[model samples]
Target: MASPIDNNVSSAKAVLLGALASGVNGPTWSMIKITFLTLGVCLAAMLALAFSSSDFIMIIHVLLLVVISGILLVLLNRFLAETGLVSIEQQMEEMGIATKDQIELSKKS
Candidate 1:
């Protein structure tokens, strides 16, 4: 009785749920945040560069910005881990209240 549109919708929902269920730890979350932040910066930079720079040069600058931002975020993550501060995983677990592994174990009980 389901229409093709309904099937597609359900399939998309399943895929989205599966992605959410996949373990996304603190570093991953940080990187995702960094990517969006970098994107915003790139957009602003592109607007500013539009009049002054060629298309190719603008593209190259954006790429370089992305790479540098990623590297910096990675280093920050490592530094946090290396320090005696609370680990990223612990912070995420605390914020999430219950991780996927915990939920699975609870389900089995």
Candidate 2:
């Protein structure tokens, strides 16, 4: 019979393993990358505003920066999706490495 402490340790290990496995296949890392990219853009815009002496010019600059950033992000997202960096399913399909039929056959087995 196992002691309570051993059981707790085993349970903790199981929980840790499950969490790591889930995280490995999760989108959290991609979301973190996107969030950092957005923050970097915002920081750059703030730096640009800081460098300008006129308040009106600063506002205009910030607005233009935001609009340009939005457009750029949209284009980048579309480009990444097309390139299959955003979708593993698309990437596999594009490479012809994993077709739907192959997946279905594997599942049937």
Candidate 3:
């Protein structure tokens, strides 16, 4: 028989693998598409500026892209969570990965 800890680990792995295989929801996918489009446009603009200038530091370009992507991801995630479309706690409870009693007990511990 598998221990409870092993079961939890296996279940977590299964959920993660399933998510990786199934992809995201429609709204998430749309947001992802927009992110890529925005990134592509930014890259194009950066490239244009770099070509026009004599001294273009590559680190600035990398930092700009990283910062923009990070901000976009944070804002989009908050929007999704606010819209009730991406609640990890709710999903875990529904999926039997967690329960109110277990959560309460864990908290007490």
Candidate 4:
């Protein structure tokens, strides 16, 4: 209901702000925060669904939701690790494409 709407709005705001923060500061951290927040929201949505529906039906829904989310998260994490911001940042740094101040901290490390 209204709660879901409110959660969605706030979550969207967090994502937008996270992007902005990443742009001005650390892209890697920013992307990590955004990804984690998104995962959190997904988990929350599934939990909310359990609240809205109860008994054996709710259990089935939650089980399916968690399974799907776990699979997706695992795959995405692996993909990102294989081609993370660090790699992109390194390329940008080498090419002098990043702003003087926007250099990625993770890449520097």
Predicted model with the maximum TM-score: 4
RMSD of model 4 against the true structure: 11.9
Question: Which candidate tops lDDT?
Answer: 3
In candidate 3, what are the lDDT values of residues 1-109, reduced to their tens digit? 3323224444445445335433333434455667677887887777677767744686477557767877887886687566644333334455676778765554455
Query: What lDDT tens digits, residue by residue, belong to model 2 across residues 1-109?
Result: 3323223334334333323442211143355456768876776768576667568777776767767766776775676556442233223334454567754544455
> Cα RMSDs of all predictions?
11.3, 12.3, 10.0, 11.9
For model 2 the local lDDT of residue 98 reads 54
Quantify how close model 1 is to the true structure by its C-alpha RMSD in Å.
11.3
Misplaced by over 4 Å in model 4 are: 1-54, 86-109
**Clashes in model 2: which pairs?**
none
User: Which model is ahead, 1 or 4, in terms of TM-score?
Assistant: 4
Local accuracy of candidate 1 as per-residue lDDT tens digits, 15-60: 3332354443343445556667877686667756853666777677
TM-score: model 1 vs. ground truth: 0.33
Rank by lDDT (best first): 3, 4, 1, 2
lDDT of 4 by residue, 1-109 (tens): 1222223334344444434432321344465657777977877787787777766787787778777877876786787666544333333444454544555333243
lDDT of each: 0.52, 0.50, 0.56, 0.53
Consecutive 10-residue window with the lowest summed lDDT within model 1: 1-10
Q: Where does candidate 2 have its weakest 10-residue lDDT segment? A: 17-26
Give the 10-residue window scoring lowest on summed lDDT in candidate 3. 1-10
Report how far residue 73 has shifted in candidate 2, in Å: 0.7
